[model samples]
Target: MADLRPQAMIFVTEYIRNGNNATQAAIAAGYSERTASSQGSRLLKSVEVQQFLNKTEQNLNKDLRVMFADHAVNAFNVLLEVMNDPEAQHKDKLVAARDLLDRAGYKPTDKVVADVNTEGTIQIVFSDKMKKADSS
Candidate 1:
């Protein structure tokens, strides 16, 4: 099966729930006007829809619009490579995210890189100022 991200699925879910046009979702998930509607239809009917809708919707923030614009533009910037090879998409997304963060002046490295167990769940540790009571 294809690797569909929850963020993409939420775009589909909101489109369906709102009974809106594919233009919105198309714009959201990095697709073109010529193919947005068809792509939305495909995502709407995807089996992964149920597993992701609620969580993705909850996680989407105001910055999503800006981030999405970056994703689409970045994706199209590498369209030639994407058409000739599938592996390039991941690189495209990573570059897109890095570019988005850079443009917004958000540096990921400054933040703590929480370690995750073999299961891939991140384990976050808090700093002293982030807590309440004084130390004994």
Candidate 2:
């Protein structure tokens, strides 16, 4: 079987959340504008679908969510700092960030640079910001 597409998976999850009208959701899900009703019916009738839907519904937050909006600006600043290095490449950004993070008492993992767009601009997705493990 082929690997599941992320968009399709997300669409399914969204559909499970608000699926009173199956045909309407199918068109919105990009699966098929015409076969939404049948597809939604088939999925709704499946045991696997029932379990998946129940689990997802249990995890869903219907209310407005809390966010660290203060952290958002700081995050953008950090990105700017990473992008300002003379090299501005993955390896260089990682090294630069590692030094700064270490000095600030945060021990984040060494950055792994990935070029997602094939445009040569490296992206460093930091895995963690671990506090000093133990000094005492």
Candidate 3:
């Protein structure tokens, strides 16, 4: 389970279960459409957000009777087929590859952690995006 607020849990689950559409998920989470894409991208980078997504995906797979090792293997096999098919759309192949990588425990990004003491003060640091921006 993610240590996120209730609204965030809703956003995370909706984002994953709804074709990975962040904008729609943000809207469903009550964010303004004008800022939804950026908000969704930010949420996607949160450790708690990714954790919730992975947890929910696992739960959903289990509920769908696809949690068995054999089933997972079969699913991967299908993804491979999609990825290798010459006639497959580029987008379909990319999606299949992404799904395969995700199911096989490949994370394309590192996590950023923030530690706050029991005091009432807060210390925040930007790591991922800021680092890239600075390098650029």
Candidate 4:
């Protein structure tokens, strides 16, 4: 990665931290209010800055996946307990079972209905230009 200037680094950090609001990030990085928007746009257009943002996003996604996986077993166990408990209310058990099935890729398909009503004449016109070209 290219060595970013202090202000550029701050802009990148603030851009991510502030929900990808470039203008706000530039302002937070001490850019002039009048130029913050353009400065942010320029920084984001830089190859080095883009690479940094992509890498940061990838790392954050990986970390979140790991965190979720770590607790997946506990979540499944709780759901199973609720689903299998005979004392549980029918509604509660059904909801738990549905959740488990949905997560397991056994969700029911949704039904869709479409209504169409048209009261207009349909017109089709052949262009003389096409015929003229074909004749040539």
Among these predictions, the greatest lDDT belongs to 4
Please give the TM-score that candidate 4 achieves against the real structure. 0.73
lDDT digits (tens) for residues 3-99 of candidate 1: 7675676576657566566567766767777887887777767677544554556566546877898888766556545445655666665566666
Model 2: pairs clashing at backbone N, Cα or C within 3 Å: none
Q: Compared with the true structure, what per-residue lDDT tens digits does model 3 show for residues 20-114?
A: 99999998998899999998999999898888888888888887774476687888889999999999998899889988888778955654545
Ranking of all predicted structures according to TM-score, beginning with the best and ending with the worst: 4, 3, 2, 1
Clashing pairs in 3: none
- Output the better candidate (1/3) by TM-score: 3
Q: In order, what lDDT does every prediction score?
A: 0.63, 0.60, 0.83, 0.87
- For TM-score, the strongest prediction is 4
Write the number of the candidate with greater lDDT, choosing between 3 and 4.
4
- TM-score, every prediction: 0.30, 0.35, 0.46, 0.73
lDDT of 4 by residue, 45-82 (tens): 99988888888889989999999998998999999999
Model 2: lDDT equals: 0.60
Cα lDDT tens digits, model 2, 1-136, are 0243454445457676575565565566776867778876775676665565566665564322224456656765776687576758877686667666665689845544455666767665543432233332
What TM-score quantifies how close candidate 3 is to the native fold? 0.46
Please give the lDDT score for candidate 4.
0.87
